[model samples]
Target: MLEPSIDALQEKINSKYTLVTLSAMRARQMSETKNPLVDHPFSHKYVGMALEEILAEKLTIADGQKKDSE
Candidate 1:
């Protein structure tokens, strides 16, 4: 079973698009830093690690902002 299941993840972020975007961004950072925010992560990959962080409530989206007119 996946450490951080999609169904569980959805509870953290309602939007799948936002979830994907947020995870990808965090994965990139983890790849660079090589640090695991959560202890004993089940997945070794950065993407999975990122998701775990979200599941554990270690990472979060503060707020959303609208783009201004050009």
Candidate 2:
């Protein structure tokens, strides 16, 4: 079973598409930088670390309009 359940993650991210996008992007950043937001030992994968960061509310999505404007 996934440590941070999908349902819990969905609550943090409004849609499945957004969740996937955010996790993948964050995971890639982590992989490049070799950084883990959470001090978790369970996951050695960047995707897992990203999800854990999301669950812990350490990562958040900015409003789409704002992001697009930037």
Candidate 3:
């Protein structure tokens, strides 16, 4: 089972494409910066950490195109 289930993530991002894109972009940023929004990320992999951030509501899409997070 996916740790942060798809259903749970869907609540944060309505579109799957947006979700994937956001996750991928965030993951790349995380890999390069080695910094995560969540104090304690559930997964070591950047992608998983990104998903966790989404589930925790620490990350969000603002005004459709903007991305915001702690």
List per-candidate RMSD values in Å: 5.0, 4.3, 4.5
Clashing pairs in 3: none
Model 3 agreement with the true structure over 5-55: per-residue lDDT tens digits: 999998788778878988999999999999999998879899999999999
| Per-prediction TM-score | 0.83, 0.82, 0.85
Best prediction by lDDT: 3
| Backbone clash count, each prediction separately | 0, 0, 0
lDDT by residue (1-70, candidate 2, tens digit) is 9878899987877577777888999999988899788875378888888888989989878755233224
In TM-score terms, which candidate is top?
Answer: 3
Per-residue lDDT over 1-70 for candidate 1, one digit per residue giving the tens place of the 0 to 100 score: 8768899998877677877888899999988999889999989899999899988989877656331221
Please give the lDDT score for candidate 2.
0.81
- Provide the clash count, candidate 1: 0
Residue 64 of model 1, lDDT score:
64
Stretches of candidate 2 exceeding 4 Å from the true structure: 64-70
